[model samples]
Target: MWRGLRVALVRERFTVDGVAALIGSAARAALDRGETTPARRAVRAAGAAGALVRLFLLGDVLPRDEVAAALDPVDVDEAVTAGLLDVDETGVRAALDLRPHADAGLPDAPPWWVLSDLEVAPGGRTADREHVLGTGAASLSLARATVRRPVDTLLDVGTGCGVQVLHASGHARDLTATDVSTRALQIARVTFALSGLEVECLAGPWLEPVAGRRFDQIVSNPPFVPGPPHVEHVYRDAGLGGDGASALLVGRLPAHLTEGGVAQLLASWLITSDDWTGRPRAWLGEAAEAAAPGGLDAWVVQRDVADPALHVGTWLRDAGVDPASPEGTALSERWLDWLAEAGVHAIGFGFVTLRRTAPDVAGTVVCEDLRQSHDDPLGPEIEAWLDRTAWLAARSDEALLDERLLVPDTVALERGLVSTDEGWSPVAATLVRLDGPQWRHDVDELGVALLGGCRGHLPLRDLLDLLALAHGRDADELARTAVPVVRDLVRHGMLTAVA
Candidate 1:
């Protein structure tokens, strides 16, 4: 048993070329047979390829039980010493590292640690300190969540590990990736090459490579940590304080985006007491000045909030810095000092999606900060919310009554059905949660309903009067409660005002 386990480990490390070829061939064949569609094929290939790559690095540590209980103490020791197995005894794992194509100003020679067979380290003792290629959950989140759209070109600013480039390859016919670190571009190239995708990886600051190029889609996961700056990592720092880097990057988008183009990004922002809205809005002003006067739709969704210390600590850990270590402690001190110096106390993290289009085109800019379950994003709920809003925003009380619709017996605020931002146009309905669904309100059942009753003939005001009479509520009170709800529904597309 020990001999067989040792053999398996050797095959995983790719140290034994014959075993590696066999593992690679089997995994590839399995993936090919499993894939039925392009999406499935991509998923299968990525998973199978990653597994095969891991086997080469982490083979020696495979549990003895899984391999007929053959692992010996010496085999485990040798594997650990060789840097192919992790320190943890039970859960052996491999780091997924990648880089883009060459000519991105990265070093021509690969890392000595990388084994020749799969061109990656075989459990080499390498610390992921550098802001190199992406191999994190957030990076994958951005990659997978991105939906393909019609676009002439795409830009990935601050492209690390070129994960964005890898995902963007399928969507954008032409792709350009930029990073301040030439080393990052180098890594991005390696990743892209291994994955069999081509992208123009540039070694430069954000938007520098394509100073005048216009793209239909632009996506970035910029260095969004807010802090003071001295020495900076090209992938992270913008020589600014809390969310300063994000501002700096966002402030540069309008001129770079083509007409009717959209830019989606995840970033962090400092929440100020004065007005949370003004800070991010300032980016739009800067963008407008850089390009032609056009329609701009900005949607900023704040997903999470954290205090300065928590924020700093989270980022420090993310960069693989050990706070317990002397160097890590010093780095942490510097980060805290930077935040203090920046006049920032708390930070908000979330997404910002912007669309640049023609003026006079029906477009909108929405900023919302809401509590949501991150683990379960209700895509269907959001879709339903949108559908209800569309129906509401398009019709008037009279029209709604004419349709002779039955009001739902009850409505609950299941999650989100309202616009949190001010200055939105109004719709003429109320949002109520129902049994496993959301629906409109019954006009007759509602006492002093904000919207008119569905009497099948009466205009909105008369229906309100009828409701008012039934409920013994005054006109002023009823109007105050109902008009805004109606307006909100209209604005939100929950109810429609007749054209």
Candidate 2:
């Protein structure tokens, strides 16, 4: 039955591009905004694809004959028995949310189908505790940020509906998915089957099912929501106290990673004080110190932050609870009380990437706020970050000075000007990266001269000496001051070591 449905979907061109072409971009954009009227109108004249869209995407009930005609070779009774469709006196509707998804960053990649529970309508009843989610913002972000280099083995922890595994299938040799909810595992199995992929699904919380086993790569979109220590929805709540789920993964996942293995996960943490990095730094510090042989290198980027009130309201609506209603008011009060008592002033949402290092090597953990917009995939940037940091770590000041460096074209220098009595004068100079993370750094005249001289022609020591001579300063003192500055530039990809 799954094979027949797959064939029918492919034959009908029920894919991401196919659907967009049929409905137009406006209707597609509307569907993303949770308004299906435009899509319904656009697909009214479409054939089998239209029927499938109405039945599955728009949550509209179709006549039995139309469904039968759309899903040819796959008997309606078979589909019903397989729990893919539901029939009532009115007509037939989708029992699940099956839709086409592809990596927008990889245009050449083939489209894949995903199966999960349908979304709850606004003001409708809350979702089931065990509901599995399909492609959404969090999942898509993790997918886009994931490092996609080929690996021998990969693991997806808390694999709700197995969307991460679907993205990993192209680059990983062996795939394993683990979840705490059996229902989610079941849905993920069907998702894999429909996508024509094989994955080992294990039912257990976070890394328990794969104890003593190591993978070359691991990815997770864990239940990192911060709230009271109780489970209302299995997909978002870890049943642990505030932000414990994120801490748990950060501390434990290192032990299960092979040497040089990389793990990326979406996590949320609480902000009790002005120091947002305090919690994550402590978590990574403990984890890396206790790790075997080599420590763990962790990079955490805080993408968004929400205050306690806004956070509560956002999640309340997400669970299908109306915040204005009596129940919602009471729930909100309780949730806010917990957060207040815990001294959490805000909540931070972001991704963490950890890499296991070689034996006897110390690891580095960097935590920072990067709320800027990113126009490109972060996988390559992250990979480069790890490499650059490692290179800097292995070099001493003397060793680094002997190496030549060059700035790539992606790095741009910007000067801020202010109107003055005479003319527009430069108030500040800043170096900006045009690619990943788009970091900006304020620089002085010496910094500008140093960067301009780094053209892969001379060693850094020679450049520093020339700058000191030009500025009538001591070369040794200049080199001493420039060592840390150069390291920072290299770490942020503002400067590159010439090979």
Candidate 3:
């Protein structure tokens, strides 16, 4: 569908107006007339009414008028049922003037329509609507990872429209969905039923609904945006204190997982002054260790860190509350005050995929920022992280350092030589390109040039002697600098230390 037509046709008022009502009424009348399968008959009648509405709206005025003059019940029925005419501009304009609010009711965003094997507008939002279920980047990421795992019992926390629950049904034996919003639960129930999915639904906040329940896989797109205790509509805000909500969800997982159970979630948390890595680790560590005390192995990667104002604006925009409005302005103020009170300058957004962290089996959680497009519903790249084995905390500088080392011939020289605007010429290089996280070195041209020559055939001492003979520079000065450069290469895992 064209964007403009979609916008016009999708409003809840339009769905309920003249056409929808007429079709509904007509379907009821047909049912009374002994139509086979009343429900299907009603839908067909409603669809016909919608089609007629579309025709009068889309057709030319004089032509439609002539057609209307000659139109009989059969013609109207066929036109409405088969969509001979479209909902045109004039009809839409007239409908707009007729006070849709007085006639049809509340405004709404477009619905997800699967037409001719094509998905049209999966979901939409209106000006005042606070909650809507639509798959986002984070949600999609979670979905991809969840399907690949061999999970028996799947749990979707805060299952808005049960997107994750639906996705998980493909792999999970038994699926359970929990949410705080009753309205969302209603939509979710319908969504599951229509999709031919059967899920056990629970209504409660956070982990309250499924207390003491253990699952092989737990996936959540929780409300981790830190703000005041409002916006309970349930997509953006989780009414928990501090990182209370995020931590609460994280804190409880260990207890709810069987030996090797895995939990995947997308969350945001306040970044404090103390150790950034230690902060998230503290949640899985500490007194809660007994909860699932195999010692939860965590990989918490700080992706995009945002300051207070950015965090505030992010959620405010998500809520669809205009900052210019009085209520919007007040919301903004309250958010600023809350963030300020918490001493939160920036918040982090990323995935937290955890396992039971049992002692017998090493449970791992890898946190890394892999920015990529997961557009395909069933693509392999989406599950790459699920197969990730690297844990930053578990490995040492030596193990990390050793990764840079090469066995003889594979080592390559990579020099970075550039002149900045300030006329400072800096040239830097290594024995083998450093692969460590923190690659630090001085910009000494001769050091890079000399390191490039070491191929293990000529001893380092011979190269210095030749350079000393050619340039007549001090061999001692050249040799001294050479040792540090080689040491740095070895230290950073660029090259293995020669035995």
Candidate 4:
């Protein structure tokens, strides 16, 4: 039974750290690079864990007796009966990937023993339409970005192996997981059963499984891979061509969100117009329109963008196609040709977050690009920034001036000193906050000089006066100039309210 496997895994300390230790740092690092040879070698001496590392984790064949010993509390017979293992004349090999998964970014969350299709790292076949994914970077990104505040109900669309549900289960009162692939749903059910948790399972595309329903929260790391024509994988590529799947899911999200509900999704959208963020904003507007009186507020962050060529190659590689091969070259050509014809200059990858708010509250669509990598668990930072934006949107500059502000301790300032023929000239100043993304706001010298006093102790008028006195400038003019900068800084999270 799944319960028995769970117990055996716990007994064996089949944890992230445990596996890392058995494999050693080199092997671990190599594994991240998708090379399993080093890791394969490192786990050779690892007793029962070795068999598991061989049979399930690494997709290597293990002697039948070794598998029986490693999975003792949950016997090999059970694993075989449970469809987790396959025995052959040579030895026993994995039918799927089974490993301990934990996210250090979310320390409060429990670890999960995950089950899914094998990966390239384990020398498994290319992920097919029926493949169920184990936890990967995209899944981890969704987990890290999701605002972890407790909610009554949560829905996970495209719930591959139920990893998202596992992350959400502790917080949500009711959980519903949906997957288009029947095999994926089966694995997800196994995931929950092993964790001693229960979740309602549905089968269909996007939100079809949950018609005429709304939830407090929804999260999906759906099939957003913009594959070339006839891409086989269901886990990454939606049947609709040219990133249609991501658009449809995002467009319909607002209607299924309860008042104050937030949906977080990782998706890729095509770059059609001159602007990168334009289409995403339009999608948000459509979702808002669908929600009607209670419009959907959106904050979509485009994390990365790639040209058609690079995008095509990336997806080709993702599907485990050799770039040098004939098929890979042909696929790339077709996708690139399509992009060229369609005027798709680039493909933008990002997270789309839509919040359904009350009828009286006017909604907004914030679409921006952030290519830099920052720290993890940015949920609180996002919530803080969103709250700040809403507050700023409601207030005029005069009211904002009256409100004392303090920059959060996480913020740092940089005054760029350009080298010239004569001497160093302080040319630029950038205010940055630590929010897992370099949130940089440019401020002038006067704005830079006046920021030291922004400790929530002084009103805007007072800070301007102080700066004017220090700089021997007109206080009124200084106030006029600095108020807007401060407001912008506050909005961008470089400055925070004292409270």
User: Which candidate has the top score in TM-score?
Assistant: 2
What's the C-alpha lDDT at position 368 in model 1?
67
Candidate 4: regions farther than 4 A off? 21-27, 34-46, 73-78, 105-110, 120-127, 227-231, 418-423, 462-484
Question: By how many angstroms RMSD does model 2 differ from the true structure?
Answer: 1.7
- Candidate 2, 18-93: lDDT as tens digits: 8999899999999999899999999898888899889888999999999998999899989999989999999999
- Candidate 1 lDDT tens digits, 63-145: 43332222333354554454334545565543332111221112332211111112223333124334453445566555544
Q: List the residue pairs that clash in candidate 4.
A: 374-436, 375-436
Worst 10-residue lDDT window for candidate 2 reads 118-127
Clashes by residue pair, model 3: 48-80, 54-86, 54-87, 55-85, 57-88, 58-87, 58-88, 299-367, 404-493
In model 2, what is the error at residue 309, expressed in angstroms?
0.5
Cα deviation of 202 in candidate 2 (Å)?
0.6
Q: TM-score per candidate, in order?
A: 0.62, 0.96, 0.56, 0.90
- Give the alpha-carbon lDDT of every model: 0.55, 0.90, 0.54, 0.81
Q: What are the per-model C-alpha RMSD values against the true structure?
A: 12.2, 1.7, 14.0, 3.0
Ranking by lDDT: 2, 4, 1, 3
| lDDT tens digits by residue: candidate 4, 57-148 | 66788888888788888777678777888787888888778888776655666557788877763443475668777888789888888877
Who is ahead in lDDT, 2 or 3? 2
Best by lDDT: 2
**Pairwise TM-score winner, candidates 1 and 2:** 2
Worst 10 residues of 4 by lDDT: 120-129
User: Candidates ranked by TM-score, best first?
Assistant: 2, 4, 1, 3
Q: Candidate 1 has what TM-score?
A: 0.62
